[model samples]
Target: MGNFFFVRDYCSISVLPGASLTIGNNVFFNNYSSINCLDNILIGDNSIFGEGVKLYDHNHKYGFNPEFSIDKTDFKTSPIVIGKNCWIGSNTVILKGVNIGDNCVIGAGCVIHKSIPPNTIIKNGQNLIFESLQK
Candidate 1:
């Protein structure tokens, strides 16, 4: 962490043992944001995040191993990298292994599971098909 601009109240950043959370200079994290770093999470300089944003660097592994079948803590981890000057919108969920490039704008309520290129503007739901379940 290097000269973070501000971290609002009720925001939680948890780094487990042997894991790492790296935040660069002038970064601003809004209220109700959470970052769970089970491996490595690197946020670059001049980045700003909106409210209720969540970032996770690990997820549960779905393989059926008998001994650890009932264990809900069995997880696989990867790193999440957010590049410089990015703006992440409210209620966004950035999952494992997502590398967001510089100067990007991610819209609200987006679940980012893949990498985004530099200087991109990503918005929500242009192809949303809301089918009724009234069969």
Candidate 2:
């Protein structure tokens, strides 16, 4: 109640002992928003996670090991970094090794696997025309 507040509902947050989930100032996590940080997951200040947004830093490797494969992971984790002033839409899945820059808008229901630069808008499977909005 004093200053920082974490409002969660129907969400399972399992951070390993000594593991960290850093929530910046004025950050809000809505209902059904789950953050599974096995390593280090940093959510920037003033960033909001909408309903049903899932962020996982770990993936399961299913193949036998000789060299390595991205598709096969035995529950390994890297790190998730989200910059400040970012708006994450609902039902968005932010995968491992993703560094989202500041002031970026992520469209709803999009699976982000790579890093997004600052002030960038990502929209998948939609035809959008970028016309001048001002007269």
- Candidate 1, residues 1-135, lDDT tens digits: the string is 989568999999899999999999999999999999999999999999999999999888775565545447878999999999999999999999999999999999999999999999999986877999999
Give the Cα error of residue 32 in candidate 2, in Å. Answer: 0.6
TM-score of each: 0.88, 0.79
Q: Write the per-residue lDDT of candidate 2 for residues 104-126, one digit (tens) a residue.
A: 88888889999999999887686
Best candidate, TM-score-wise? 1
Error of 1 at 37 (Å): 0.3
lDDT of 2: 0.82
Error of 1 at 76 (Å): 0.5
